[model samples]
Target: MRTSRARFWAAVALAAATVPSGLACIWDGDTLAAEVRHRGYLVLDALTGRFDRLPPEYYRKRYELASERIAKDPSALAAYDNAAVACERLGRTDEAIDWMLKKQAAMEALPVHDRAARDDARYRFHANIGTFYAHRWVAGGAKRDDPDALAALDHLTKCMAINPEAHFGREVVQLGMIEWLNSERKQSLGDHLAERVMSSVPYAMDSSNNVLAEGLAGLVLLGAAWESVDVYNCMAHTLNFSFDSSLSFVAALRVEELLQSGKRPLDQSEGWRITLDDAASFWEDQYKKRYRTELTKVYSQLRAAGDEYVRKRNEYVLARLAEGRHPDSDGGFWSDWTEPARVELPDRRALTRSQFALVQTLLAGGILAGVVILILVASRVSRSRKRAR
Candidate 1:
């Protein structure tokens, strides 16, 4: 009788422990579902610019709930990503870093074959961690001995080593820029680090045909700023094949600035000038072939705009020259010329009207052809079915 009573109590105790855990799991599942629903609403609000209408603590509450749920279920990777972003937006840098690190750990824990299969995801995860570290280093005033800065470099290097062909070209350029900036403060370490960072630039340029021109230009500017002739020359080589006239023009202007500042020697400047001029010419010819009628008008307008800006810049420089002063001596030359170049051309649309029209016509024609083919296939299938019957 005593033994039976003990058994009964033991079973009751087990049930009491197991029931609450089971119930807690169910509650967590429901909570996760609700959080997902709320996240969707928040995304919609942000996209529609209604996020401002939400209470200030709305994001904080969401983040807290997401973090809590993630702690209970680490497999909820999306929750981790969301919570990290929220922490970043809320200026909780340390927490953001911690969440991203957790995400990274989870990703890396996957089997090697599985990790290889999702190379893009792996690259992005590493790149994101690197970028966060880079930002943190900068936010901390770019201390020379900052561990975050070193970690940023390490992760960024890992990202490139994983897959140079991935769409992380911008990140590579950003890394180079960070290294260059830091090199100013810690000359020997910075220079060596900057060189290491710049090594990725060529990989970035060659890894993808769709490499961003702005990223390329930024790297070029960084090279110029650092007086790294090799870095800028590498960019010039890539830009030779890029065949982007506007980008070519802008790069040419930058090279000219470097030449004027005597940072780049005459021989290097000549090669860069020829390369950029050839790129401009090549793109112009291609544009002419593609849109014969619109080519003249578009080129003329772009040329006129470039001429006007150059004329104004030259006038500023000439005034400085008349004062027996070096154009950039007081750093006013940047405001006078370089800053203007950085301003996005107001009239620069991605596609000209004729190009837009051609794209639309092609799309419409393709859709019509697809519909006609579908109808023919359906009719043939129907006849086959009837014959079979």
Candidate 2:
């Protein structure tokens, strides 16, 4: 590290001192201040902590350094951005928001002649707000009704509208909206909305610092299609078991048609369509084969309980009818099957526990293998370096 730092500083000095025809200092005061501020940031981080964890002092120093840089270079966009991110990383949500808002305010204060700069700044403002809202939503204190979740969606939408192909922001916003919709129990609406958003995804779209738009668009479309299948599956399961109405055949046919379709939408996302077909096939196979046992059990249990309730209801009605009174409007069987209707909903947690356990075991094993491989590779690299020296 010392050797590398010495060499880096040597290069920096050479660049700073060199001039073709006595041109003034290459790095002006603002640039020098920016360089010093970056070094201070590195030193602050070292003094505070290491990767994956940071003491409050680390963040405090980082924020102070960035703030100083912003003060020196009032148009320093990165300084404000870094300060805002550092504040968020330090768990200072309000401070982060304030810094970001100030960054936007400063950019807006710039002259109207700089229209392009203003536009860029406006995009950043909406994008950062969208990012913050998404983080808050995932952090889970905010419920479905939380205005922050809505605000996040709104910000992201605005960002995309400002620059319709902001692949990165659009992807995050779409995912956030999907999650928010799921949390709000508006799964159907989410599915349809996701479908629309995905349909408009640019094929070669590349987000800054990432190649995610195409891949994520594929995933979102596939997920929405499968979600549609799941909705029908659930409906079929409910009707088949609860009401003795057979909708599985119809649902299966619809899912099959979707899987088999070679229409424009499906052709547009062939990569995703293949995976979607696999899921649909899996569900359809379950319906054709495995569904019988589960549906049979559920139906038998429900039907038996329902029959008992009906029997008691009929008995009560007949007894009433036999009495010197009519069993019509006043003595209907509506009051009879209350007990069966009150049966608790199946506990999804309990139902999924075994599957969750299996997934956890697989994940733990995979992580352990990864750690061992990383250690071996690191050791091999260390030995190679030593030999080279």
Candidate 3:
């Protein structure tokens, strides 16, 4: 009888363990299906711009389903992420932030063996949260002391610290934009942000210092579009080129467009209204413009820079070969070279206080003079009518 009791208790314990595991699998499957359904709705909305076509209750239902599943399984990070996105779309910013924070906590709980994957996930989450705050700040009319702006700066800083090399190009451009937007409110912070972005140029160039010369060229074009003379000068100083060689060639073409059209290629006000195809066509047209003979002098300098880079690269490779090591092994070539020093930027031209005051005074005076003339004309008409009567 005692032996029978022991066997029964053991069977009960086994069943208890198996039941929860089975239920967990079922819950996960449901959550995944819900996520897939949510994504389908997103795609439909994107194509048709018919987010309202779905009943108002549909999103609530979906959110509820995900939330319930998340309550049961705290590790449902994807569900939490989807829930956060839905909340944001529904105009529930605080709820969205809460969901994102929960998702982040779940990610942090990942085992040590998953460190690499966790870091990558953490970087993405931080960057995305930063973007959300940035959008909110813009929506709020971009106040200097806006909490959203501060949050964005903090999150983006965390993202940079985690993986500076992952998306250097895009991140640097974003930083520049943020700094420009907020400079009036916090001059020191904006200046510091710009300096940090400028510092990344050398690392980006170094990473691209191979036969393809790919990295530095794109970064230069991006910097030029952002109107960063530091980036332009860095390219010039490092490459000994004029303005028409390598990636600078593309930037020079853009400069020509700016001078001719008096419009920036990328308009900030339009935001996401400009399509990718439109951007591509604009670039294609720029590429097809007749090469300006004036740029030839700049091209000559660029060629010199290119030649010098090649000479240095070859000498470094040969040295590595002499040392009985592979030339490209672990990026040994040019690894010891020092990055270019920061160049002094030219002072920007602005109207003095007196000049600004003079312009305003002239504008006000013009309006007042026009009003006085109208009044005198009316008085004359009234007197002429009275005399006729």
Candidate 4:
């Protein structure tokens, strides 16, 4: 009997232990606290390179496990959110988006009062989506008008509207907006929007304080400002013979050439020198002085690329000019001059036109007056000669 009582008590202890696990900890308030703590720990681990403390490829495996767990539970939105955030840091944007979407769906299933955290998570997810779109747009140039970019823009805008700084959404939206403005064909709109983007840059940079993010922001601002210089050249009377866009374009082109040619800062200056005439010369100087050596290298490369692009464009322009074609306001060199060539009127036609008629009449009057004077002179001379004889 005593042995039976001992086994019963042991079984009760085991059941009590399992009760904590079986009671569905999803509704537990303490679960969120643990989740936050786990996130902090993961962040710490990532920072300290504590890979040994975590499993090999902990970020990847953890996300996978979290995804599996959420798939089974469907109510584990908090866990999924945490995993999605970690995935983002790991540069797994697609996986992150998936997890975030699940989190959003789970959040919507919850009550209004319980939705704040989930909504914030959604903001972050959308921001990353925007970033993905921006990168794609930059990569594809004129060809990135796909559904992904459109969806990214839509999500980012909604995220921004919900919470501007939520998950650093504003920066994502602003960066995407800058890319859009930069690629736009309308010069005036591009310039105005780019200026606004540059103006808001400091705020966005400060919000994240991410080095790469800030560096990109700086680069973008520099590009926009340089492009603005191009627009100024388009309208400036002083640059009628030499477009300012050429200067900017060349500066950017050289940077690109350097990057593509695998040339370094100390490489041969074969049409690759950063000269005073470069559109981003001043900006490059600032970077050289302000940034670290590595960062300076990146900035220099970007500057060179921008300059090289401009140079190639200018060379193309000069080539077209050799073919008697001209660079147009729409950023293209064309042989077709829209305006008609000037033509001079024939003397017969000149006699019929109003202004030409006036001139002709005056000329006729002058010739007649000359004839009368000559006749008078000859008659006077003839009379003088007869009297003398």
Candidate 5:
């Protein structure tokens, strides 16, 4: 690792000092930052860990604090929500679930006379519970008959009744995933990623990534399906297949990993019944047939940028998202399930006689002014050029 780091830094330094001037124009900050995000998969995984999460104790304390709030005041609804969040951070999913249920039960027991208010009130609880339930099922195991998965569907259905367009109707897309998985791969939640070539196109049409792509590729469940070709194919379909995305490379690399060795440990297995190494040839054949993207070229580009690019890109993108392009601009790994409705422009007024005349006069004057400015600028620039020549 130390030698790799030494070599990596040496390469970066040498490249920075030696790369052509024209290359500067090509590898702009945005491009470099975007490149490093997929850094581990694209080039090298040896760089920094800027995106590393906080320690579990931090989350445990957060949950405990929220729990304390509930102990002091059973009516502290916000505490219930906070506890769920803390549990999520702690990866204590079952506890996360318990908090949500407690929140719902407390909410139901609250003295609100109006039934409409009560139903409307049910929206958030249902939504949160549904999402957490889906999350639980995903991480627990990709079991077909998982009750948590089914329960999520029920809660989300109720949520949809109260508000059809909640969370950009994210629940609906999640439902598609659930239904698809439940049918044991009979359903189609998303499509294939294809490349166009003059002669042959593999994995064609399919608009690989949709709004739904983020689900399977997220931190939790995706790693477990590392050896499953079908899962890889589904991920290829499910993830928004950005040509530049590292996650996209991972789907392709899944086959390679299987070919290398499918002999993964069970008690300490990260995920998998087995490594599927026995079926490596089948996987390699599958990779040749499906994941046809030539990664060598991609590797060259990413290496040219260097491994330290990870920290640089993550920081840059996070700053960007934090500054503006977040919350909605970029479709995220998380929710945009429903976005805030776009506010419409105000209706145009019918022009009165005075309004029409004023509008015509302003337009005429503006055009005349523009013409004069254009003429003056053009004349000066033309004369200067002629003299220089």
Candidate 6:
């Protein structure tokens, strides 16, 4: 099925031309949160230093144990959270929201005297609810009046007061997402949010990241709408003007390797999915012709930065693919996570930094040996000449 090339490039032009207008800034408050976007691992990486996340079965057993704890004591707050995580992992997002709400009500009903001491708990509850509601809103078709939007905003607003100094408006990306969806991808939202979005955009994934921002950045660039040539073109513009150099692109690329090859964020759910046989093929052809060299340059620079940098890039790539984003087994370099082994790319050095150093050491040693041999030969020749004299 041939796609309308004219419609596709138009969206591409539009997406590329519009810039985020908000006064958003890179959030430096949470160091751990920053790395999550680049590597795609959180609790698992933090605890085991492994690049893997817990499997679905792990969530299942966790839910069972947490439920048993809850039955014995309804006030087992963490247990409610545990169960909610399990539900989310099982694709039961609404259920996850329910668990968080239950947790919220339980917190609300606490004695006023006890509430002061529970600010920490309240903060956690609001963040979790905001995430769940925003997620639900997306899954619910990203409608303008989705109750989830207001619910997310209500909870996130409550977040502003709990720790006024430390919170850092971490919801910047999440809120932009809600607003963007509500506006139906129009320029009006950008005009409204431009400053706010710019103030918090993470120029780099590892050092200054809001996974939410990083995640949403990728989300806006790609989604289920890509089959429309317009959407496909819009998605493939990895450096879509909205994000530009202040930050760059990928999750969609991995989603795109399923896409025509680009990435989106969050690493979950069918509502956010994109798959099209002809559209993907068309984008693939267009990408190879127009974007591959550019992507290769960005990708190569990161690879050259050293193993740690490459590791983070690989993690983001692998995490997106692992979520079942790829339509085919061949997801290129992103098909599997690289660990001690790094995948090679254009201009990627064949040696690690340490390996490069070792090579330099050996070459220097060889040169020194040659110099010594020349000196010895010169001295012997001089001695022979003297004896002849």
Top TM-score: which candidate number? 6
lDDT of 1 by residue, 84-191 (tens): 655655667688789778887876666565655567555656766676777678788888758998988888778778865333244555666567656543322212
Model 3, residue pairs in steric clash: 241-301, 241-302, 242-301, 242-302
- Residue lDDT tens for model 4, 157-259: 6765665433212353354444444544332322233233333333311111222222222222211222222222211211111122222233334344444
Q: CA lDDT, every prediction? A: 0.46, 0.42, 0.43, 0.39, 0.44, 0.45
What TM-score does candidate 2 get on C-alpha atoms? 0.37
lDDT of 3 by residue, 1-389 (tens): 23322433333233222222110000111223333433322211111111112222434545776788789998766567556655655667677777778878888776766777677667767765675676678667887758888887787778767776443244554555555567553322222333444354432212112111222223332112223333332222222111113233333333343345554422222121212222122123454233333344444444344345445545555565556543112355446754222212111112333443344345446656777999999999999999999
Worst 10 residues of 3 by lDDT: 20-29
lDDT of 5 by residue, 1-389 (tens): 23322433333223223211220000111222333443323212211112223344444555666778789998776667667766765667787778888988888678988777667557666766776787788788858878988998798778766765333224444555566666554222232111101011111111221222332332212112333454443343222122223333434344344445763321221222112222122234545323334343443444344334434544544554444443222456223322222212111113333443344345446666777999999999999999999
Scanning candidate 6 in windows of ten residues, the lowest lDDT window is: 22-31
- Backbone clash pairs for candidate 5 read 167-337, 167-338, 168-337, 168-338, 209-240, 213-238, 262-275, 262-277
Alpha-carbon deviation at 216 in model 5, angstroms: 5.0
Off by over 4 Å in 6: 1-54, 109-117, 160-170, 188-194, 199-258, 261-389
How many collisions between residues are there in candidate 6?
Answer: 33
For lDDT, the strongest prediction is 1
* Alpha carbon deviation, residue 54, candidate 3 (Å): 17
Per-candidate Cα RMSD to the true structure, in Å, reads 24.3, 26.0, 27.4, 34.0, 22.4, 20.1
Instruction: Quantify how close model 5 is to the true structure by its C-alpha RMSD in Å.
Output: 22.4
Q: What ranking emerges by lDDT with the best candidate at the front?
A: 1, 6, 5, 3, 2, 4
What's the true lDDT of residue 81 in model 4?
55
Model 6, 1-389: lDDT tens digits are 11223333333333223222222211111223334542443211211122223346545666777778778887767667767766766778788889888887777666666655588677667766776787778777777778888887777667645743232334554455466666645332322233334434422111222333333332322111222322222232222222322122332333444334333343222223333222223233545433445544544444344336435754565565456442122335344544453332332212333453344345446666777999999999999999999
lDDT value for candidate 5? Answer: 0.44
TM per candidate: 0.40, 0.37, 0.38, 0.37, 0.42, 0.47
**Model 1, which residues run further than 4 Å from truth?**
1-72, 105-113, 117-122, 185-243, 247-389
